[model samples]
Target: MLVISGAVQAGLAGIPGQSAELGISLTVMGSALAAAGWLLTVGWRFTRKLPKPASDIPQVEQGIRITPNIIRVVVIGAVLIVLASALFIPQVGFPDAFPILGMLVGFLWSVAAGLACTGRVMKTGRVMKNSADLYARWLSRR
Candidate 1:
């Protein structure tokens, strides 16, 4: 970050307009790459592929039924998502990205809640047949 910022600053000089924007863009991308490389080199767990547990495969391979708890979570998540969307409406306009962020949080909460409750994954109107992934996630959380 420091190196890219320093190099970009020195290169920018009195050079105005487009070049400066380009330099800024380059600096941002370079910094991102540098950070990623550093993480990879320093044993970042997420940098490698996750190992699949053999025992975790069966539930995913076999479909599961949704439960009443999952339905409740789905409705709640939907309501939260709708309310989050409302915040972005012009009439209710707020000057922040909180609404956008909330929508994501609501969606993730719905999915996770549904999984934890019934071992099911829900999209807008559809339920995924797999429960192995959910079971594995639940196991990891424990």
Candidate 2:
């Protein structure tokens, strides 16, 4: 969003009589297309390979371990931050402040949320792996 905002501002500022609204719309639409393309690629890769059954798949349980609470909290926080950034950017105290402040806040919130979620996922994944290994050993001995 910040990226689009900055592009729009720059584009409008560069033109002699271009409408800021028009520039903003164009930049946002272009960014949406790029984002959609990236999402498609990720979805394609994610669904391309199917895992085998648990009994035949090593470390399968590791993938199942997820912290729903932390994920939800981080997601909510990120959404709030993005929305706040978008709304506040235009109202900032100085000219040209929106591009810098808005982008910085938005990116920082996103990065922070991602890191929190990743930490939870990593911790849960490790616990799951340990449990799975212990369970497999016990079953083997039985």
RMSD of 2: 9.9
lDDT of each: 0.49, 0.54
Q: What would you estimate as the lDDT of candidate 2?
A: 0.54
Q: For each predicted model, how many residue pairs clash, with residues at least 3 apart or on different chains?
A: 1, 0
Weakest 10 consecutive residues, lDDT, candidate 1? 120-129
The sequence of per-residue lDDT tens digits that candidate 1 reaches over residues 1-142 is 3334434443543233223444456457767887888877786555555554345343543424445455566667767775866665565343233333333444455455546544434232132334456657867886
TM-score of each: 0.23, 0.35
For candidate 2, lDDT tens digit of each residue in 66-120? Answer: 4445456656775686577667766544344443444444544555566566666
